[model samples]
Target: MPVREMKIDDLPQVLQIQKALAFQDWNERQFIAEITANYALCVVYVAAALHTPILGYAIFHLMGPDSELLSIATNDSHQRAGIGTALLNAGIAHLDFENGDKIFLEVREGNTKARRFYEKHGFEPYAERKKYYADGENAILYVKAT
Candidate 1:
């Protein structure tokens, strides 16, 4: 998989893959619109396979001096194959963290698998917010210091 910053033209494909992997039903249009409108603050990655069009993507937002991971997902057909990790590495690489600080992100507390994935990448839970999701799930805040 070749990971790089996503072009505006890639939004549709990225949103489609993300919505399909979402555990809870949600509107992907909002995500697409936000990333499109906020490209200056967003960094996304697309994973292309040997014979496939695109397998998955990851998006992150840069706010002030901090980088926040917005979302990350792999196509169902490509899950557990390291595409997600590749996307994450690519997203982090795009950040202008010359100060060598930490990156942040929030994930559903019930998403044990995703939590473990972040932990494997050096993200540590530092806080939590209640009812952060449309489904009323709590969001666990994780940070990784580079």
Candidate 2:
């Protein structure tokens, strides 16, 4: 698992994964903006020996001691192979290096598997936003103290 800063060339593969796994898809401009934002960090996980295909990606923003995990997703074909875990670990390490004290993210209330995964990774339920998604699903917020 090679997790590194996302490059412009990786956006295509990243968009593919996002379209498959994300609740809302972001366009190339959004991805580029996040990657270039001063307060943001964007990374991609490449699994092949040649590092050609991106398996997953994470976008986070750091503000003082707080960090927000904006998005994270793995390719549908590469799920369960630890790519998501690796990308998360990398994001955590980056945030810790930046002296961040906590990280937060939101998941759909109906996404039990994602909530379970976050729980297993030391994230605890913190709050909820009713009718947060476009489909009217509630959003469950999870927080982790780093």
Candidate 3:
């Protein structure tokens, strides 16, 4: 699988991928605004194939020096095929780790699959935010320290 930064033309595909994997309503306009405003380090991943639709994407926000993984989603059709891991690894590699020794992300408390994915990548549970999801689930904050 190949990973790269997302282009403007990739928004629709990205949206589709997000919808396929998302557990809540994520506004595309808000996502676009945040990404464009922080384009210096934020990115999205696309699996490579002949005219293949997007299988997954990851979004990150670099604040100060540390990176925050805003969201990561792999389409349901492509789940369990390592696409999510590939996207995450690619995003992690893109960070300026020499200056920032940590990456953080949040997953819903009930999202066992997502939590397991983060844990498999060496992320540790560090904190919790109550009612973080629109559906009223708390969120567990996971961090990977380099």
Q: Which stretches of candidate 3 lie over 4 Å from their true place?
A: 39-42, 47-51
lDDT of each: 0.72, 0.85, 0.77
lDDT of candidate 1 at residue 127, scale 0 to 100: 96
Q: Which stretches of candidate 2 lie over 4 Å from their true place?
A: 50-52, 97-100
Please name the candidate that would achieve the greatest lDDT relative to the true structure: 2
Ranking by TM-score: 2, 3, 1
lDDT of 2 by residue, 1-146 (tens): 49999988899888888887766678999999998899998999887665547888898898768788888888787777888788889988877644338899999999886788789899999899999998899999998886
Clashing residue pairs in candidate 3 (N, C-alpha, C atoms within 3 angstroms): none
What is the C-alpha lDDT profile of model 1 across 1-146, one tens digit per residue?
A: 37765666766676677667766443556555656765434444443444445676666776656778877777788778887788888777667576767789999999988898999999999999999987789999999887
lDDT of residue 125 for candidate 1: 97
Q: Highest TM-score, which number?
A: 2
Clash number for candidate 3: 0
> How big is the positional error of residue 110 in model 1, measured in Å on the Cα after superposition?
0.8
Candidate 2 TM-score versus the reference? 0.91
Looking at candidate 2, the ten consecutive residues that score lowest on lDDT are 92-101
Q: How far does residue 146 in candidate 1 sit from its true spot (Å)?
A: 1.5
The estimated TM-scores of all candidates read 0.79, 0.91, 0.86
Q: Give the range where candidate 1 is weakest over 10 consecutive residues by summed lDDT.
A: 40-49
